[model samples]
Target chain A: MAHKSAGRSALARVLAVLETFDQDNSALTVSRISKRSGLPVPTVYRIVAELLEMGLLERGSDRRLHVGVRLWEIASRAPRALGLREAAMPFMEDLHAATRQHTQLYVLEGCDALVIERLSTRSAVTNVTQVGDRQPLHATTGGLVLLAHASLHMQDSFLSAPMRAYTPNTPTDPAELRRILANIRTRGYVVCDGYITPDALGVGTPVYSPSGDVIAALSVVVPRDGAQPMTHVRALRLSSRGITDALGKPQVRHGPQNIRLFPFVNNEQL
Target chain B: MAHKSAGRSALARVLAVLETFDQDNSALTVSRISKRSGLPVPTVYRIVAELLEMGLLERGSDRRLHVGVRLWEIASRAPRALGLREAAMPFMEDLHAATRQHTQLYVLEGCDALVIERLSTRSAVTNVTQVGDRQPLHATTGGLVLLAHASLHMQDSFLSAPMRAYTPNTPTDPAELRRILANIRTRGYVVCDGYITPDALGVGTPVYSPSGDVIAALSVVVPRDGAQPMTHVRALRLSSRGITDALGKPQVRHGPQNIRLFPFVNNEQL
Candidate 1:
């Protein structure tokens, strides 16, 4: 069941309802959902009634609907998301402790860099990346790392597309970006100084899966001034290797560890 | 929109299919979904087909249907789950750094202790609480903290119900548990040594919302031997106060910081 491109299916309509809730637009009335989803008001109510029944959608005392804990609970089991996040967490934590900057993990999805997990202290540089928020593959250090490891076909397609420049330092020329991607692959990491923001520097390394494929990117964001890029990269590579090792051996699963943690391994060993 | 306890609606059937997959059962076949959800094989096939189209479910190379990244993307926006997780992360990281043990943030959901976020290194205690997993109310320190703060009617109902005993230390008698909850209320923290596992000790404190209602609990798990349970509780209370202060200020909502970290505030200040 690839898709029902012939017409909008009933399930698509339900998904549209869920789509209306996001980081900014979390709580909404039925009419707002109808407006956002482009479905009729009556249809919104009917679907929301079902979602509410399933506890997938909750109505607050204020009578606005929200994405429910049940939905988040079910979604937490997605292997591509939480599984990767789980494998990356301890390493990310260690990297954060060492660098005292922002540490982020990413996977390539739909030509955009999807942030799987991010850790930052309040003192981190002014970086505007959030987990699950997609960034342009050309603008982010993690994105370039993934693009470097991505299929040639995907690379070619990305190179042919126009690049958006957020700042003077963002690499906008496709040919130059292709060369940067090549350099990233050769070095196993990339340092994008002021790519997203003027005051930020991003250093990213490759994270491998058990099958030895570069499945994700682990990146750190530090302040541009006096930033030791090589030092950060070295620390990041250490964590990346740890995550890779954890993935190589099937990670022992335990917790509600954010409700539990993987006590099977030791901190010093990593 | 409460619930139709009568005949199943189409959305109800869809929810049944989604609910069949959890922390343990991530992948399932059409037949398995049918067996667990109690829907017909053909019906399961039909719904799975639609779910696949919507990218709510994905088929592996092995062809086992699993929860989709798209669904997780949608659910990640859940304010209660990720919102709290985001607000709690930096402090949890600080606590984890200080204790180097398991750090968890939990919200009370229904009658169970729902884990919203957890962080730990490889050498923490043996506890099986995941971000989305639920634990018995009377068995976990976080659960008891929330129970202590719950409404009187809710407290009475829980106290009047049968409590399961997982270990010799897990409190089963409502009267004894009630006294323990009272102590928790008086001291503003709870320490449960060997409550779930003989080797693990759990220390917990309350996390309040902006309105001062107990919305969640911040907890830590350490090795039972040389645990210094009171010491852990003291550290937990510090982070709990930080979390509560951050929450009390209408927690600056930004990113997946973990469970509930106030990104707007700096860590040095905390």
Candidate 2:
């Protein structure tokens, strides 16, 4: 028998404290954390104390709290993020060195594309994407590639809603987006010009797992006027395939199998 | 009034569950988690359900649970880690490109040297260190550098203990360690040969904040019998200075001061 009306388990409240932290508010006073998480001040204080003792949260000289290095260490050991990033790094490095632009690796999390890792050159074009940042499925090249290979249910849900346009060139109409997704599936890659910003062009391709399922997307963002975008796309595809091959290796296969497959119909190409 | 003993608080139990997953065990079943955390099976089940719903953890097809991407995203945005990481990346990249070896940035946490970031070449010498791994204070070059410039109480407490000898060359005698620390302070860099591992050499220098307090250590590890370790020491010193200059920039300064000066006498060379 489960109690449905506990109003939120102690676990949820603890997670709530962690969730209160974000990019803009990395450090917070206990009162602020309480306000942000909607946890009672005393409860927040007690939870914060326990977290501090456990090394999940740390306090700085300012008396404000921040995420602890121990938490990062534990999370880094997680097979999903670090495992994929390790397998993808050498390839990502090659792509970054060759293009001398922004190279990113993303995995689909629910309805959003979560950027797991990114490398950018000093003179690269500015983009809103950052490691650990989320982008809409219809507005980013990596997101589009992932969305193109995503399940039919996900596609229907994404297409049913009004898509937010980041720039004038972004395909907001569900019909046009549906066509683009079809083309991505057929062409094995997706390239969008000024989709997120007028000055940037994004190109991406899918990465596959051993079972030939599209597991992630690798993309490069370059200035719209920069060198031919096709070159980056070709490099990304080659690198993505290399990563897939790496994933197929037996050593990495022993890790978690939570690799979510993009629900594309034809899995042969991947 | 505080609850005398609210079953260790649901938050504490949840943290214990997360804490049980580390580098050695990244994925576990509910039974394993219960056993490792000493929590009852029924309680573990209920909390894991809430955690899965909140995307704090995910269950793989094999029915094993692992840390979730959502947790990583939330932790990644913390300014202490990401902000420092962002500021240090360019310099770290430069050091890595130039040396083609293992380059690391670390800060003092508790009694260990906590690596905040690291970059390594595939062919570089084998190092047990990872991005968030912690190494003993006296046995690591980075730790030694941080210790040399740490508060008198910290330095004494660390040196006073019987240091764990990781390798035959590791400095264990407190008097000898103090002498070596004095040399590091005078030379502005440290060359630790066969300290952490017999096959490796670690070189390190202190990174200072705007107020000229040591906040971190920058180091490089290379093969013991390879080229002169002094070269890496020079590079580390230069990179440390570069990071200190970056930290001194007015645009980056925010919040309360975290600078704490070392209690030892300032040697002019450093």
Candidate 3:
């Protein structure tokens, strides 16, 4: 369907080569990319060569290929990711400082919660959430907050799907999950004890927009051992409100702020 | 030269479309993309269709096209940007808190210092630096530190080029810049007063890797009004050391921490 519409398998081929490099497979050999992408070796080689020239891919001294910095520079302008991140950063900093844990801001993408921003310290617990990473809607506290506030159609579709059980405590049963979601929408926050991992407790609340729509989720993952999850719930709710207030402001810039380091001709272009 | 090499100029054409979206032109119409990229409208349609299918480009509610979340997700794997960002975030947070100003982490990309991470509050003085944004080597304090600690070959090549004079005070004379670079290397930090923007002062220091290579720079931009550039120097130097120490650590996870919100088979895959 994708091929017939665009009529350019070249784009597909390029995307296939790119799909080979994920978190674990960041650095890959040409042969490995060929095998993983299921593209012929020669095609992969040719595509890699083109990507290298375009600065979309780079080769390391170890002869491993990885995604290029140029690609990141372009993608950094993504409104949904970088835009939300720029808005939430200050509130997130306050939340992180107060909680001293793995604090994160997430946006609903597809059937998962895609983390747009995250703040962690060296001595923090084993909360592994990272920016640009996604978590299933049923397993994360932030995900549940998003799910609860999502449109009824989205909520129904998500609940009906067979959800993955992240941990034994992960509520996969649709009926049980529905009850949890409903509770979250009412309380405006949710605390999950050992939902994703046993050692961490997640507290999450929704970040709203000027139109009163739930635009994002704010949360903290703290160690479960002697941890007061309610304490973080208060902070998350407060920070989420701060983020909403910041977003509601008209003067707040979106995406990357246009910095004018050089006043030669045009500042916008640079 | 690029057109001749790709054989399939489709990659170059696709990149041209992607390049049409930037800080100012974050959202563009199909025709705008065609005009900006100088590609035929039909050719743009074909490329855009393919890009939309691959989730590399998204169409906004306003019917404008933008770089998509998927692109950001893929590019987030970039080691030079995201990896360094991961290691420096905590130290950056501490620096921001201590100074209560715009704290930033930058890496030398080409002849510019590319901002990898930044921390700021709403009331902080006008800090125009943004994540994934670039500041010219001669204009920014961070850029000067990177240039100072850079390899001799790089330094020589950069100095020989005819550089832009950002402001009247911007050091355009290569000999003057050479002296500044030398001073930075000797003093361990730099403070640029009214170099980039007239209202801001930037203080910077180098972050070193375990192998003693200068991997990144740490800096802050505070208002020039009663701005004690020397006061921020200590904070910046200490944070630079903290970032260097963090990077020097063997276990500092590259990119975003490998968040395991879902344990169904492979959390890394999700």
Candidate 4:
């Protein structure tokens, strides 16, 4: 039962209404929703009424609309987000505790890196990454790691598209990025200094699935000053391996005592 | 915009299809979904096609359908879930680290407690409370704290319902529960020893919003043996206060350094 008369499906129009609510513009009026979704006021009102009835959208005490807890409950069943985040949380916690910086986990979604979870120390750095936010696959450390391991077709398309340099140090040259991706494959990690932000340094490593595919990237962002790259790289590689192991053994869940952690490798000394 | 042709609205049908996939049945085939959601096969197929196109549902390599990451991204913008979570994570982390047990946050929704987030130590204690799962208001520690602070009408309805005793210790009598709930309000915390599980004890405290309404509960589940209920209560109250402060000062954000933690009350001595 698509909405053929409306020129778009009913689900599409409803999604348009939902899409208008984001991190910044979470609460909005009906007119604002109509403006944002490009739908008529009556259409927006009808959709909003149905959504409110279904508990997908809630009107706040201020009378502005917000995404409801019911929608969050429904979306929490997403295996990709819930499973990976659960598997990676302990390792991420360890990394965050040790470094007192930002520990982020990202998955490759449609040529962009989608942050699934992040644990940040309040005063650690100036990184702007937030959970559920997407960043370009070429300019961020996690993005580069994920893109390097992504399908060759995706890599080709990404390289062909015009890229933005968030900072002067961001490598925009496709040839140079290809070399960096190749090096990341060889080194098992990547260290990007001032790639996304001028004052931040991020080290990224790939996390694997049970079938040996790189499912996600685990990264740590620290301030540029006193940024010991190898130390962060070693910690990230170690944690990513832990996540990979956890992902492979779904039966052996959550107990730190059950999983055997890998010994620390002093790659710099080596 | 509503799906008037079908018996149920289009959005309702879509929600029904989405509801078929929960934590246990995350991956399913169309036939199974049709069986579970009770929709016609062709109707389910058409809806699934639309959902797949919109990236709300995904087909895995095994040919089973699963909830997509795009849906999770949309749900993550849910202010009720995300804002509370971001405000509570650090405090939960602190509690989890100090106690090495299950630290959970819950909000009262429709006479039940909806677990929004939970931090568990692998071997701390056995807690069946997964994030997004619901528990009865009269049975769980977090539930009682939330129910106690909820509207008087909600409390009355919950008390009138036929309750099941999960264990011998679960409070089922309306009079007894009312007294316990009243005690909880007076004490500003709850200690449920063997209420749900005989081997576990839980302590819960209320978290306030900027407007000072009881928005959520911060709780810990620990092994009943040697369970210092007072110790757990103190930690929960402290963290609940921290969460309240964070919720109030939205601009101050994540720096633990900025928030002044309250001194331990030593309530036992008092």
- Candidate of highest TM-score: 4
Query: Which digits, one per residue and each the tens of the lDDT, describe model 2 over residues A88-190?
Result: 8888878887877889998888788889888875678867766777888898988999999988888998899888777789899999999999999999999
What are the RMSD figures for all models against the true structure? 6.3, 7.1, 6.7, 7.1
TM-score of chain A of each: 0.89, 0.89, 0.86, 0.89
DockQ of model 4, rounded to 2 decimals: 0.33
lDDT of 1 by residue, A156-221 (tens): 888887888888899989889989988987888899999878888999998876556787889999
TM agreement with the true structure for every prediction: 0.88, 0.86, 0.86, 0.90
**Relative to the true structure, how large is the alpha-carbon lDDT of every model?**
0.78, 0.75, 0.77, 0.80
Superposition TM-score, candidate 2 onto the true structure: 0.86
**DockQ per model, Cα:** 0.36, 0.28, 0.34, 0.33
Candidate order (DockQ) = 1, 3, 4, 2
Best by DockQ: 1
lDDT string for model 1 (B57-163, tens) is 87754578887777888987776777667777878988888888889988777788889899987887787777778988898988999899888888899899887
Q: Give the Å shift of residue A258 in candidate 4.
A: 19
Clashes of 4: 0
In model 4, which runs have C-alpha deviations exceeding 4 angstroms?
A1-5, A252-270, B1-6, B252-270
The number of the candidate with the highest lDDT is: 4
| lDDT (10s digit) by residue, model 3, range B1-270 | 112223438788889889888766777899998888777788889989989877788776567788877899888877666766776787788888887888888877667888888888778876667777888899888899989988888888889999876656778789999999999989989988878776788888888765566777888988888988787888777777876666555553422245221100100100
Candidate scoring better on TM-score of 2 and 4: 4
- Model 1 spans > 4 angstroms off: A1-7, A253-270, B1-7, B250-270
